[model samples]
Target: MSMQTPKQLGGISFGLMDPETYRDMSATKVITADTYDDDGYPIDMGLMDPRLGVIDPGLECKTCGQHSGSCNGHFGHIELAAPVIHVGFTKLIRRLLRSTCRECGRLALTEYEREEFRERLQRAKDLGEDPNDVLKSAVRQARKASNCPHCGEQQADIKHEKPTTYYEVQDVLSGEYSEQIAAAMQPDEDDPDDEGTSPSELASQSGIPLDRINEIVAGEFRPRTEDRKALESALDIDLTEEDMNKLMASDIRDWFEDIPDDDLGVLGIDGEISRPEWMVMTVLPVPPVTAVRRSPSITAA
Candidate 1:
């Protein structure tokens, strides 16, 4: 028998699974958070669904029809109600947001700058060199642009708060407007008969739910006239507020989708293998129970 020499490793690539791919690999859709029912049986479509592989010794996996010890287990998925930013990619998302045009979703750099960076990226790729430095420089240059070269729209400063929040900062209200607004909102102590609108009434009129108030305050939601009016009427204030719009995962995903494939290399992303939008999770993959379950010996120990 002849022995074959091992082949040399060329490179390694990591990619995120898009929603469709996640769904395709999932054994079942995990609809309920419950693991077991009242009878102690695994609930269908729950976290411990038999289709996701059984943890119990006697039970067989519903999907693979193998006993607990033999079954490698299958994956389950949960469809999120709303898109959310992946915590791991918060920095990358922020960098992408800052480096791209808010209006056109193109790189904020001029044509010459873009071409230059692209050339640098291509050279790095050809040489099998790390392109992170080139990407960082390109992103740094792009962030300096106040207006998008492609669409000529004024760009706002992209701010990333720790964990997962992102905000677009733009000046909307001047100092004079702020003072006038404050004065209008202040109650007139001299007028004994005046009863101002209450905070509850204003909140109700704003059409924003209580749960979303934090997001609204953090600039995740765009300001609407009704929302502004509610605060103004409640305080009896006339004011122009600064634009601190929150960028939600869905919004970011849309922006990423608009980015040209050719430009992805400059951003240090391989468009063919992965996409920026995939960084924002719409579907969550759940491991089978057996994979996560502790062995009886370990538990006893």
Candidate 2:
């Protein structure tokens, strides 16, 4: 067999792997979590599956049929127990979540606004200025929009929790009223006869029945205690259990790819680039076998 000289590379490309990409690259489905056995041998069907080629000289590599240093490492994959956000794209996730609407999953900008901003960005580019400056301005404006221009639903504030979690800042005002709240904002001053005017008399003055005003003053607006308890209990579903439901990597890839070009452009990403949501790591790439294998050190005799 004749060997061909390697062509000189012009540039290297890096990208997120969709599920199909992951499947195509993987040599085996790693069913066992173990990497090596007690004797340091690669465990069968484990993370260091032999189908992923071999690192030890004693065993023949399954894929390349080479021993030890002669074989290049092949990739094998283990299905994740749960989805995790990709650490690399934390900032991108925050930026995308904040700029897009939760309800409609669309950018907060109106069609007209996006067009205008697009023009501004292009003009800036033409003028030999940084288009990113214009993009940032548009993003700033979009972030302030509270409602989705497409859906008309209110947009909740997107918050980034520590260690790669995204949360919506839904400030649900408690409907329950406590006596402490009433006492904090006392409505009445000194009335000579502590028992203020009868509901009828107050009603006469305001044209609204004094009884109604009394109900308002006495905090009738507060939800009854039993009702509040029921509500609290009803909303107490376990979030951890909900998170256990696995989302397929392919579906997630589609979601990232589905974000409109204009929306991604506003976030300073061109259509050719992956969306910020791709930061959520669906597939993990394994290093080359040669990279992981420890090379023997030569010592001077």
Candidate 3:
């Protein structure tokens, strides 16, 4: 009972078994005027409610509260045809709608309509408009404008954002920060590394450095996000799972291990390891452990 699909546009709405109707109608798809949205949902036909110039089918009337109306002002005319049953087959009936006119809203129905209107709609449909055009026009009407129709604020400045779905969020985020995001999605604090040790294994096997690990993990002394990006670019590393594991296992001090203080140029921190060789550290993730409990015996009272 969606209020806005082509079924609505074709002046065909309410409830019907679509699969059964498709079989009965000998139709393969429930196509409307426009077949897709930006993300590819079939546009609803209610977009360009067509009208038949004859007896008001009452189905297309704008009178919302009377005669079991859907209250949509679309679908001016509908052509109702008999359920075409072939031979010895019985099937459920579902209504299918197609827009006969893109303007002055009209439709062909299989349920309620007089023959005169059907003939008129047939002539009009034969004379011109395609269902696809009507659907596309409707989608255009439903599209969001740059400014809020009510308040007139621009989309960028608006506070009430149209909540984005996971799909849209991914589309937008991937398009904008594909590189940075790629860098960020390294092996989550799990999985093994080159040395055959997971972050948790490294933590347990080398516990003495836990404090330093915490410092980096908690963002206390590690390089700022910007600095990390700069280093990533300098190393020409992807900062992916392998790269992250390598970085996490090795201390920053190891970067300048045997290079003399005079050769601090190797790090290019303006000839000085600004972070100090001693304080530079490696981080290992801690493992999560679950408490195992023995089942208690229930003694008879």
lDDT of each: 0.78, 0.62, 0.27
Instruction: Give the CA lDDT, 0 to 100, for residue 275 in model 2.
Output: 52
lDDT tens string, model 1, 1-301? 7799989989976787778988999999999977777766778998889999876768888999999788999999999999988898888898999999867789998889999998998899899998888999998999889889899998898888888989999866334543453354345789877664343443575555654544444445544556656655655655464778988888988989888777776887878888888998889999877887643433444
Q: Lowest-lDDT window of 10 residues in candidate 3?
A: 89-98
Worst 10 residues of 1 by lDDT: 173-182
Give the TM-score of each candidate: 0.72, 0.69, 0.14
Of models 1 and 2, which has the larger TM-score? 1
lDDT of 3: 0.27
What lDDT tens digits, residue by residue, belong to model 2 across residues 188-222? 47754454344454445445544554564476754
Candidate 3 deviant stretches above 4 angstroms: 1-128, 140-301
For model 3, residues 214-288, the per-residue Cα lDDT tens digits are 443344544344544443453344332211111211222343243333222111212232322222222211111
lDDT of 3 at 176: 22
- What CA RMSD would you report for each candidate? 12.2, 8.3, 32.1
RMSD of 1: 12.2
- Kindly report which residue stretches of model 1 are placed more than 4 angstroms away from their true locations once superposed: 1-12, 125-129, 173-242, 294-301
- In order, how many clashes per candidate? 4, 2, 25
